[model samples]
Target chain A: MSHTYRYPRPALTVDIVVFGLDAEDLQVLLIERDGKPFRGQWALPGGFVDVGESPDDAARRELEEETGLSEIFLEQLYTFGNPGRDPREHVVTIAHYALVNLNEHDVKASSDARNAAWFSINDLPKLAFDHSEILKVALDRLRAKVRYQPIGFELLPKKFTLRQLQHLYELILDRELDKRNFRKKVLATEIVKETNQFEKDVAHRAARLYRFDQRKYDRMTKQGFNFEV
Target chain B: MSHTYRYPRPALTVDIVVFGLDAEDLQVLLIERDGKPFRGQWALPGGFVDVGESPDDAARRELEEETGLSEIFLEQLYTFGNPGRDPREHVVTIAHYALVNLNEHDVKASSDARNAAWFSINDLPKLAFDHSEILKVALDRLRAKVRYQPIGFELLPKKFTLRQLQHLYELILDRELDKRNFRKKVLATEIVKETNQFEKDVAHRAARLYRFDQRKYDRMTKQGFNFEV
Candidate 1:
């Protein structure tokens, strides 16, 4: 313990809560611990932050190392630094949250993780360490943020029907929205553009498909547009 | 270094952006550094996190020790952890932002601070060690968050006229809002209950004052009430 600084330093780590939307509900990616300190228990995919490495980079690297997922957009959720959170020593973990399309990426267990699986947010097992609290905070952020920002689109396919879009919002918000009012408000925002396409396989009616207009959203955002749902 | 951990841990710190409002514009509290490594330069009031202390506790303690302000409601804004942020070492700071009523508290320069003072957000001197970036992030958070949440009330007196409340919003948001529309929306929220008292020392017509009903807001929030201004 003979470093340059006089005070004792706390160890730092990074953890990420990855959210994916499926047909019925919202799911999160968890990895089963392969080593000590809660072996055989599930936790968020993360590890120690290397020296001279940014916390953001550490989060991405650890997620890719343990879950085989990369190129995903991650938002810094919050930093958990309770002294008693870690068992070994004073460790603080910077928590981040990400949204991904469920059908796009497949997770593989690697690194210090024994197994990687997706569990519905409603039906999660007892996680290791203070991970359960981290996941709850991430879920609250996702629920609150999806209303003002269009991040829920990250959990959906590129081309989708209005019903599918509403379903994404409903799943994240954990409530059923009025169809007519939801459609009216979403259309009024003018960020979802109507594509010259329709749903392919449907029994009753084939609804028209729409795509999120990023350029329009960006331009409107610059013009101080208020996006609320 | 002979620590139990295999990897070297980066030093952790906490920096807080303290914001208060006046009639003219928004202001932030800064302290002049009294030690080496950017000594004599103005910076946000903060210091290294002590061992075995929570980051939130460190934030409150540092704010009180350096600036003599305590019991302020501090919100975790964001964590800035780039390697080059601190020239002395690889330091990661968990940043927080707080809003205070300008007339309530007085600040004294103590601990490592040579002098403490409030400056307008639009006009700030050259700050030390990525403190400018931290202040900017805090200001952006305050501007974006005050609209959706009623955190702006923290910067106002317990009993305030509607005009004073509107002026507070206009200063923080940096925009002019229609008087009729602003009052209509604020009244519609019903969180700001009208009081029987009226303005005392005004040259113009005395407007009725109001106070924020925290109990009602809490009850309404549990029922899924959304506050927007």
Candidate 2:
């Protein structure tokens, strides 16, 4: 079934759009490319898809190698392939986005990258390649996906106050949701288990913390329960 | 900012999943490969991305050349780039799905295809490469998308009967929907404009005809309206 027929193949690469939520705003992780065609320029953390690795694996590997972050929720966003996207060659990049807890790990620039840092989504710098467009698409997907799926938990810490959860939604959606309604809907789902804990070193009253219960979510989903806010 | 540098790149290709709905079952168009690398076997309609065209353009062009289908609703589904997917080469296929009205155009196998035919989703033949997995993902996307989007209309005629519309939904979701409730919801949306027409030469009752009003749908969507069945 295989013979000496030869045809040129297009180049493939994997790009990661990591979203981190700080206290103030949503941030995206970017790496300074140390090599051309976009050397010394900031772009998505990515590299060539290595042999024997799936696109998802390549994306996760690149994210970890470039940002020192792993074990987060990631999903394929879209593939970008404009013929002239890369100046040096014909490169098609499969873009994926991941949600990680910002407070869990301190980011350090990888040895292969010039620098790695998180920038507020609202004020992203001029990026190398067509990464600005890719980030926009990823943000749109995150906003839409958060509304229907319970993926926002991935961006938050293991234990979080209700105020933080509400703020996360407000930042991602770019709208202020009704506090009472949001709380009512969220609590009704019963996916968040209240922990006997409270925030420390806060000026205001310390709020109780809750952890997302994945098992409860699965059970409710199997029973035809829906979650939306 | 532009200079030549030696960096690795992954191979890219395009894969097309053509979906058609018959009277009783949903079908997908498959092509029999006549050349090496799974010769004399069925596969998705696809090929390598040309150096001069965008991935989206390559996908649409490939669909046209292989299946003789053009100007239909097409979308970028996902990119599959498992390094071990293609035996002869390191290929990453950007999978696309096109919804074609089977009644409008007859698919004539052309280009590199030896034969093209519609296979019912329930009963599929052995496919070349990893096309079987690609087709399953596309079908899952179609089922999820059809429930929230008006994409099902793309597979129907310009003007079709209400019964035809209901049948399309039932076949896609693989579930029986109450006809009365289905009619209530669909008519409520006002996306379908009733024509003073009815089906002809039927053994049973002559169903009323309706046409999808794209302009009205667009206007409604622009006014922050949601379309759900």
Candidate 3:
């Protein structure tokens, strides 16, 4: 406690809300603390920010370390800086959120000496610290942002059918959308390319697959495209 | 130099990107530094975060202390925590941005012994530190947000003409919007209420004035209304 600054300094940490689209709803990644400070309670997959690393870097590293998930895109959500957010001391956590395809990564509870698991966002367990508040904010941003941004696609596989895409939107937006209108409006944006492939290993008829057209979306965005659903 | 901790703590600061609409273009509030570390240079109005205050409170206090403005909407934009961002030391800043109506506040350059000024977003002078990058991010967010959010009204007066609303959109969006289409789309949202009033002190035929109905907007938003341009 011998810091000589004009005022006391707060310990900084990073927390991430990783959302994945399950078959029926959205889910988030959580880690069961192996030790004290909310021990055995599930919390966001994050840790302290090392001395020289940026908060972003710390978030990415922590995501990989605790969840065994890497190479996913994450965006800064918000910073939670209440003086007593962390019971251990005066710690501030920069919260980040990311969308991921669950099929791509297999999550294990015991990785890197940490226990990780996936919990349905709507029915989450008792979270540690102020993590529940962080998750709520992340969900609100995901709901609002997917309307204009193409981030929802991150939760789906590269090749997906119109049904899967519609289901993804329905789960996040929490509204039943008309299938015809959803198809018409999405196609009008010209942001999706109809692939010749079809869904594999389905009990019913396999619907045609479509891929989000990154190049077309980028060009249209530059030309002032207003993406609304 | 006397801090005693398991890890080195980075100094924390708060920086604000204060935006305003000044009739012709979007503008930002900047302070001309009066002391060293960029003395006499233009920078965002901000300072170090006191230990006990949250970042949001720090931003509000700094905005008022340095610019003589308060009680406005300020949202946390992003946190910049890369090493070497501040030359003086290892400092991380939580960046915030706010929308203000220029008519309501009188900006002073020498308020509280600080030199504060508003510069047009496009014609801003070279700024001190990494403030230029911060300003660019804020402008992009503003342009993107105005299309879906009713925040553009923050830049306009309580009662404004449809022509004034259209002009504000064009200036922020940097596009030539068709008047007929703009009015039809905006009216369909039902967020604006037409007042039995007209613009005064204008040369041409006065246009009907309108006010954004906050209560209506809040209700519509609760029902999942999508506001898109």
Candidate 4:
């Protein structure tokens, strides 16, 4: 089937930047393109928006189809519509960013994706089509948002040590924090609750685990409680 | 001339929510449509993206051509691309929000806009298409963003009294802030510099005026200064 327009329209696409936390650094997901026009180049896992599907739905569908990642919450980041960004035509991409637990989303490249892998944000290769710029914007947003909101919990395990939580912030913010001050502020915020659990099977002493108290966070937010780190 | 695609593509457009402040309340600019499908209906001032034009450029051009607004910084808010948003065909709109000094920009309707006027956000007519939803989202963003960012300065005059500044926050946030706390926080941020000027032609004792120091704001932001009101 073919469709024609009196005036040419820019082809719409959706790109996603997925961030996950590993032991040492923050990571982003990239896929090797298998088609012409930047084929074999590493790019964000995304595709053209299908007809009858909303951009949000298209983002979710493309992420799952290409990278085997689903059920993750995706937030609309920005729209990149530079005329020559896509060599094939005037393709405008609505970019989105997501946070996921690395352990839960075991990626398997499928469909149009030649290969998919996670690269530490600190070290990344040249990306195809303005994706590097898009990823940079997403990182800036993540850094600013993580400080004021408790979104860092999305990148950690359900039960984690305070040290682990602090490490997540340090990685995202790219700065060292005073250990005592970090713990004091986090506990004072009361967004994380102590669990009657601790780590198992480690050479070093195990630390008690805590869970993010989402209900308390929501309640406190309603009452205008500010969360900062 | 026309172009054809192998698969149907959603027509792309841009919609902007321009916010300004009046003496009494926060206001939004709306244009009465002069075209079919929603003739005489109030809607956000926007139009279709022409070929070879970026969405950002399209937004600025449309805002200028339809509402006589130019040189305003427009931030991309979100993409609304649900099917049936436009009765004509599948259309995807990249939404943007901007802040303008009400006293500086004088809006005059042209092109497809039959009339242009400012309406208090609290009192708006039935907007065309999904604009009401779009406006609601913009309002939510503005309310949340103004709390942490100093964008509110765009609404007031170049030099304003502390009372006017407080009123801007109170109106956007729809709440009464403690006068002492608000003043202290504003002063401590150091983003607002006290001017050697005071209010002129007032019915009572004139209050001192201040100006938003963008240079100081940028420098302090680089040094990790967070502004909260």
By summed lDDT, the worst window of 10 consecutive residues in model 2 chain B runs over B1-10
RMSD of each: 2.9, 3.9, 3.2, 2.5
- Using Cα atoms, each model's DockQ against the true complex is 0.48, 0.39, 0.43, 0.75
Worst 10 residues of 1 chain A by lDDT: A220-229
Model 4, residue A131: what's the lDDT?
Answer: 95
Residues B1-229, model 2: lDDT tens digits? 2222344345567998999988979999998888889999999988878766788999888888888888888899999887778897667889999998889978863554368889999999999999999999999889877756778888899889988999999998888888888999889988999999999999998988999889866765444344345
Candidate 4's residue-wise lDDT over B1-229, tens digit each?
Answer: 8889898988899999999998899999998888887899999988898877989999999998888888886888888999979888888999999888888777853454268989999899999999999999999988877766677778888888999999999999998989999999999888899999988899999999998888976675445444465
> Model 3: per-residue lDDT, tens digit, B1-229?
4345766778888999988887788889989898889899999988877766788999999998888888887888989999878887778889999988888877763358877778887799999989999988888888877755677777787888888889888888888888888899889888899999887888988899999889976775456544455
A225 in model 4: Cα distance from truth in Å? 5.6
List where candidate 4 sits over 4 angstroms from the true fold.
Answer: A109-113, A217-225, B109-113, B178-181, B193-198, B217-225
Pairs with steric clashes in candidate 3: A109-A116, B109-B116
Give the candidate number with the greatest DockQ: 4
lDDT of 2 by residue, A1-229 (tens): 2222244445678899999999999999988878877678889988878756789999889887878777888899999989788886677889999998888866763545358889999998899999999999999888877766788878888999988999999999998989899899899888999999999999998999999888976675444344556
TM-score of 2: 0.91
- Residue runs of model 2 more than 4 Å from their true location after superposition: A1-6, A34-40, A217-225, B1-9, B109-113, B218-228
* Cand. 4: chain B TM-score: 0.93
Error of 3 at A124 (Å): 1.1
Off by over 4 Å in 1: A1-5, A109-113, A180-190, A193-208, A217-229, B1-5, B109-113, B193-209, B217-228
Largest TM-score belongs to which candidate?
4
Per residue, candidate 1 scores C-alpha lDDT tens digits across B34-142 of: 8888999999988888779999999999998887888887888899999999897789999999988877777753554269999998899999999998998888888
Recovered fraction of real interface contacts per model: 0.51, 0.47, 0.44, 0.81
